[model samples]
Target: MSKAHELLKKYWGYDSFRYPQEEIIASVLDGKDTLALLPTGGGKSLCFQIPALVNEGICLVISPLVALMKDQVDNLMKRDIKAIALTGGIHADEVITLLDNCVYGNYKFLYVSPERLQQDWVLEKIKNLPLNLIAIDEAHCISQWGHDFRPSYTKINLLKPLFPNVPMIALTASATLDVKKDIIKQLEMQQPKLFQISFARENIGYFVYETEDKGYKIEQILKKNPEPSIIYVRNRKMCHDLSFQLSQLGFQTTFYHGGLPKREKEKNMHLWMSEKAQVIVATNAFGMGIDKPNVRTVIHVQLPENLENYYQESGRAGRNGEKSFAVLLHHPSDTVSAQSQFIHSLPDKEFLKTVYNKLCNYFQIAYGEGIDEQFSFNLNHFCSQYQFPVIKTYNSLTFLDRQGIITFSQEYSEKIVLQFLLESKEVIRYISLNPQDEEVILAVLRNYSGIYDMPTAINLSLISRKSNQPEAVIEATLLRLKEKGIIEYTAKNNDSSITFNEVREDERTINRVSKYLEAQNELKQNKLQAVLDYVTDKAHCKNSLILNYFGERGTADCGNCSYCISKKVTKSNSEKDSNVLLKLIKEKPLSSRELQQITKISEEQLIFALQELLDNDFIKVLPNNKYTIN
Candidate 1:
């Protein structure tokens, strides 16, 4: 066996590499730059991982998401491999120590974000390490034509000259031909070998249903499937509300989203991952870098923004090669909802400029200044201050972040800090004077320590629960106490933070990337249209349509999706049942009930057969509304 296969068996315990994985590993081991387009759950990681293991030096892996990077690092460490992820919020001294470990401690893998590469100290340290390979996860983000483009990713090629001879590998779950070409160019690869496994998930059956009531449909699907399933919604409110609704209906359920706190998110994910929760209702944020092989059903409560997201989300099901389903439930209102959510909320160039200007002004950053300045940003308050629509303004900030104009962190958090001005006995005396504040003060004193020494962060929700008071009332009491100088209190109700990456040059900054802005808007429109077409068109095979969209040709139906199933039913009934019904109808004119009594077939099949005959002019409805052979 080759070293790659031997290392894979030793660490992963897999008897052999999956198809094309071995081939991709061979190409990478040959010191070739490679781009691999494997679908989600296709073991894309092992292709780079095994090669890195076979090599002598540490592999540098660059990714965009902190969560994904952490997950991979954790997995590698579990296998007794030394790996480190240099994510955000790390101190300079700590980063230096981590880099030192990579150089001297014989670490095998180092994961860092694209933005981290922009730092001079990091790049300088990287040039000193003996690099083996450069692995770019979620490599599609490097392409402007890709769905999740990040301008920071485009600068990753800066590492190429530093390690002139090290081979590179770019990996993504889904990418179109345009994205593929763009990736090669952006990475400056020299005649990179391309390995694209088929994007078709044959084990997954795609289904779309149009219904007036989505909740009922969801319940029905869950009841029928009764397995580990995921129900995806569009927003955090829907994620939480639907999970609660399902729990009330007697489902073991949990929820996940980006806005959730770190501890709570991990807790909920643990419950679901341990099979304690049979159903997990989540937004699109739930599934990246997560693998659950036995997911039997994945139901979308609303239309996805695009097919790429749909394919990736649905591909999470049936990874173990058992029969599974990926269902999409659509209502008439969903069209309007999707339009509003995706299209109308898209920020134009003018709107982008307005948001950037307002953001600089909000932080009191003068023009020609504000580079590298960070601040706690409350998105709701900022929008309310300027009377801007919340969604559009948020989208504008996101666009700015993607364009590398700023770094926007949308993880929601609430912070409350408290410090007592007086000693412990003096706090007791003050509480005695203000009896109404006794419960709140006592709860704070009982649950927290060192409040008299310095400002310590406290959980407002926990304090409310402990004091048996509402959060609003607790906030008011704290403000009253602060007003009277009893204690020092600071409350920060912020959903996000922003760091300006460039000096304030409002219009000039906006104009610099206007082409990207226009192209991305047009791309969103096209992608949205493709999703709508996928759900609405019932004549073609859904599997084939997906394959064709990804530049596959000469595809065949899987004989399992919703469209293919319906076609099978129609063919079966039209050939066998239609002739049987015609023979009975020819003997005598009969109403539909009379026909059912004679044929004893299902009403659905009977209706389909009758419609087929009527369309062919072989039958007609008499004046009495009875069926007759024409």
Candidate 2:
């Protein structure tokens, strides 16, 4: 066996590689630049992982997703491999120590975000490490045409000159041909060997059902399948509502979304992953690092924004090589909802300018100043202060972040600080007089060591749990105590923060990236239109439509898709049903309901069959609506 196969078996416990995996690994082992266009469940991580193990040095991986990076690093470490991921929020001193460990600790893999590469110190430190291969995950972000483009990705090529001999591999789950070429050009891959797995899953059947009564339809589908499944909704509230509805209908269900706290998210995810919960209703945030192979069904209750996202999300099913389903429950109103939720929220250039100017003013940054300045940003306060619409303004800020105008960090952390302004005896007397607030005050004093000496930050949740009081009640009690001058309280409420990457040059900054922005918006519109067409189209096979959209051709109709099944039923089943109906009528003139009872078929099929017989003059309708031979 080759070294690659040996390592794969040793670590992954697989006897052989999946299709195209061995070939891709060979190309990388031969010191060639490789671009791999594998679908979502295509095992893209192992392509570079095994090569790094076979080589003598660490593999440097640059990825844009902090969660995905942490997941991969954790998985590698479980196999006793030395790996580290430099995610955000690490202190400067800790970052230096971690980099030093990478240089001297003989780690096999080091994953860093693309934003980290922009720092000179990080780049200089990376230059000192012995590198075997450089891999870029989600390489599509380097292209403006890609769905989730990030400007930091364009700076990845800066490492090419540093590691002249080290081969590079770029990997993405979904990328069009245009994005592919742009990734190559932007990353400066020299004659890169391209390996593209067809964006097709033969075992998974694609299905779409048009229904106004989506709840009933969902119940019907889940009843038939009744396996581990996922239901994708457009927002958080729907996740909760549908999960509850499904649970009430007797299916073990849970829900997940980004707004969920960390502990709750993990608990819910564990329930689904362990099969204690058979279904997980979630938003798009739930699938980033998830790799459950036995997902039997993935149902979209609302219209997806684009085929790229839909394909990736639906592709999550049947990874165990068993037959599974990817279903979409569509209503006519979904189109309008998609337009309002996705397209209408897109910020135009004028809105972008207004938002940029307002943000500058909000931070009190003068023109040509505020470079490298960081501020805690409360999005609601900013919007309310400027009377700007929340969604559009948020999108504008996101656009600016993607354009590299600012570093937006959306990690949420709530801080509460307090100190006792009165003596200990006085504080005790006040708490004793107000017995309702006693438990919370005692909880804080017991938990925080030096609350009497200086202001100290506290965890509100911990206090609430200890005091057996709700967080809101604790806050109210604390406010009451502060009003009485027994203690000092300060709450810093913010959901996100931003760091200025450029000096304030509002309009010029927007203009510099205006063309790219316009092109991206147009691409989004085109993608949304394609999704609309796919859902509304009844003539084409669903699987074939997806394949052609991804640039593959010469595909035959998949017999398992909704279109093929419908066509088959219409062409052949209708004839079979008609014959059964005619024979029954010839034996005895019978009512339609009696015919339905004897045929043991659906009312819909029976009605269609009877209509066909009537059209062909093979049967006559009596005054009582009974069927008889003509």
Candidate 3:
């Protein structure tokens, strides 16, 4: 058996790697950097893992998602192979213990965030732990043009030599040509083998529709699939409303989003995972870490900002290798609303600066002093109290955290940055007296190279707890470690600053970028127009036009889509209902409830058909909750 096959069976109990997996695995096994661009559900993890195990050392996997890190690590550990995830979730003491185990135990996979890489100590400690491969998941984030760019991804360059002899593989489920180049350029993969599997999930039909009655359309699709479906919405409120509406319609639906209490989110997630619920109504944040097979359909009530995002979310369907669908529902006016949302979200820097200043003042710190303090932040309260923009301010602070200027992601961690307070030779006597302390100190010196840069904020909390020393001892060891040129530290209090490495420019540039985003918003409106055209287009294959946008060729029309089914339905039910409603209402005013009972049509569907008639001025709604034919 091939070495890859051996690990696959030994760990995952799978008989064979899926399509395009073996090739990528072989390339990584050969100690050559490789980039595997598989579509979502293509099993991108095994591409790196198979070769990672085949190689003689641990694989260092860098990712941006904390949940993804945990899930992957859990899967690997369940197979009896050692894996550890370092995230902001655990206490400092826990991170230290996990790292210690990673360094000294038989662990093979260490999943960490890119932001964690910015810590000099994490870099230092990871430098010499028998690393044979570097696996960068979500490699698209390395690109500035990618939707989820992280500045910490750029810092991954420093870990290059820590595993110089180790082959590296960068894997992503979605990346356009431009995003691929940015990943390559940013990660500095040297003439790596490139493996791109086809992006087409031919089994999943693609459909785009426009109708103001989204609930009706959603109900229509779910009625057909009726098993493990996901309804993607743009906002948390919609997640609740859609789920509630679906449940009210007698569907077993659950809602999930970030804003919900973690327990509620987890409870709903568990229900979905257990297949206790048939459908989940959630924001884009719901499925990032979820890996459920047999998801029959993915429906979107609102268009995403970009195709990358849309593809990732829609790609969640059809993972079971069964025929499924990706449906997009939008209306002509949705574009206007989406544009308004974009404009509202993009706030001015002055307002952002005011919020930042207010936060700093609240913390009772001058600019640049809140290093290493911690707080539980209620964002809504903070925004309302200060009278600054809420969502935009939060976005700005997060962007600053990404830029590595001031770390607000500290909430996820009991964060501390250690600065080596002493020179290497200064603590020689103490290290000689304490060999155990000397071991950690030497590990630091061996791992982290730039100890001379004073105040290089180190994760002393992680180290003290990991090294099993007191916090003061952690502090002293850091001092001793610094004296021995091992590591150094500093801390950022909960304070955050905007550090974009971006040029602070005049209003002209901000306005310019904002306008460019505005134009993109306009193009989104254009895409909505295209959907309008596709729904109404009679010239060519409707499936072809939609799939072609997703970079697939003409295979066949989805016989299931509304466009294809229109010919078969032949009853003209929509028109018949409209005509019948018009005739009845013209005779006298009728309530929608009365109309539904008399016509025997669904209330939601009746409401929609009535609204369309109203829009056409064929009917009008009376002030007394009755409809009158125009």
Model 2, 307: alpha-carbon shift in Å?
A: 0.7
- C-alpha RMSD values across all candidates: 9.7, 9.4, 10.1
* lDDT value, candidate 3, whole model: 0.68
User: Worst ten-residue run, lDDT, model 2?
Assistant: 461-470
lDDT of 2 at 29: 90
User: 419-526, model 3: which lDDT tens digit per residue?
Assistant: 455566755666787776865565445444675564444454344333434344555555555566554444444322221222233343234334334333344455
Where model 1 places Cα greater than 4 Å from the true spot, the runs are 1-15, 77-80, 88-101, 119-122, 366-373, 412-494, 571-630
Position 528, candidate 2: lDDT: 95
Q: Write the per-residue lDDT of candidate 2 for residues 1-630, one digit (tens) a residue.
A: 288888988998999998888899999999999999999988899999999999899999998765577568767765778788776545456568778988788789989988788889889999999999999999999998888888889999999999989999999999988899999999999999999988889999998876555786688788888889999998778999999999899999999886665557778999999999999999988897688999999999999988999999999999998999999988667889888877888988888999999999999999999866767788889999999998788778888887777767664445789999999899888878888888899999998989999999886655653564555577778888889888899877556778777789988989987777778778788889999999878789999999998888779998988877766566588999998888889998887667767878764466567767977999987766577999
Model 2, CA-based lDDT = 0.85
Q: Could you tell me the TM-score of candidate 1?
A: 0.77
- Residues 268-387 of candidate 1: C-alpha lDDT, one tens digit per residue: 988988999999998887887778999999999999988899999999999899999999988656888898989899998888889889999999999998766767888889999999
Could you tell me which residue pairs clash in candidate 1? none
Query: Which has the higher TM-score value, candidate number 2 or candidate number 3?
Result: 2
